[model samples]
Target: MEAENKKLDQFTKEVIQDAGLATPSVDFLANVMAEVSKEKVPVKVYKPLINKVGWLIIGTLFLIFSFVLTRFSLGFSILGDWDLSSLMLEKHEINVDIPITYAYCFFFLLIFVIIQITMISKRFSRSLEN
Candidate 1:
């Protein structure tokens, strides 16, 4: 066993001497850094189809529509029986008895959640594509 170990050590020394050591070029780091800087990193720019003003207008219109629908469904006269001027004024007692506002809020939240889920799904799909 001692003789075999000596022979293995001698063989290892000879193999290491034959392999020789290597040195990198002086410009190797600079070249690698230059290549890395030149590489194009994808910039994800989220450009929505509908702008902020358009979305605001759409949301305002939808809310108005919902209000009108709720009033009509609840057997209330549209702008006829409920005097907006008198309601705003201190003369008439404001009737805040509609339970449908909760429903409307819930519906709006559901819609927003669905839209967010769709947008997230599209973003993930686009990332996978890249």
Candidate 2:
């Protein structure tokens, strides 16, 4: 079995060497490039998954939900017979006195990060368009 395998491998090598290497025509690259250049390159237009109208609707719904929740918490029952008073959540207040300077620093850092993210996204979008 080993001898047969060796013979087969030798035969395969001989046949391949006899066939020699295949080469493309001198103008193969040029022809391919010419055809490629003639083809139309599709322009990709960026579309937001959630448009302005969608965002506006979402924000409006969020406000409405918040208002309803606030009213419910303040004993304003939407359902007349059913009482939701028992489901009232307790509000815990933490009295941690953070320094004014620390708050200011945090605020400024948040603003800086937001600005940086905005700038980077804009630059990235512009690059994609190009």
Instruction: Please tell me which predicted candidate would have the highest lDDT against the true structure.
Output: 2
Candidate 2 local lDDT, residue 49: 100
Clashing residue pairs, backbone N/CA/C < 3 A, model 2? none
lDDT of each residue in 9-119, candidate 2, tens digit only: 999999999999999999999999999999987777778999999999999999988666644655556576565544435443446899999999999999999999999
Task: Give TM-scores for every candidate, taking all chains together and pairing residue i with residue i.
Answer: 0.44, 0.52
What are the clash counts of all predictions, listed in order?
0, 0
Q: What C-alpha lDDT does candidate 1 achieve relative to the native structure?
A: 0.80
TM-score of 2: 0.52
Runs of candidate 1 with Cα error greater than 4 angstroms are: 47-54, 70-92, 95-130
Please give, for residues 5-115, the per-residue lDDT of candidate 1 as tens digits: 999999999999999998889999999999999999887666779999999999999999766654444545655676343333346566676589898999999999999
By TM-score, who's the top model here?
A: 2
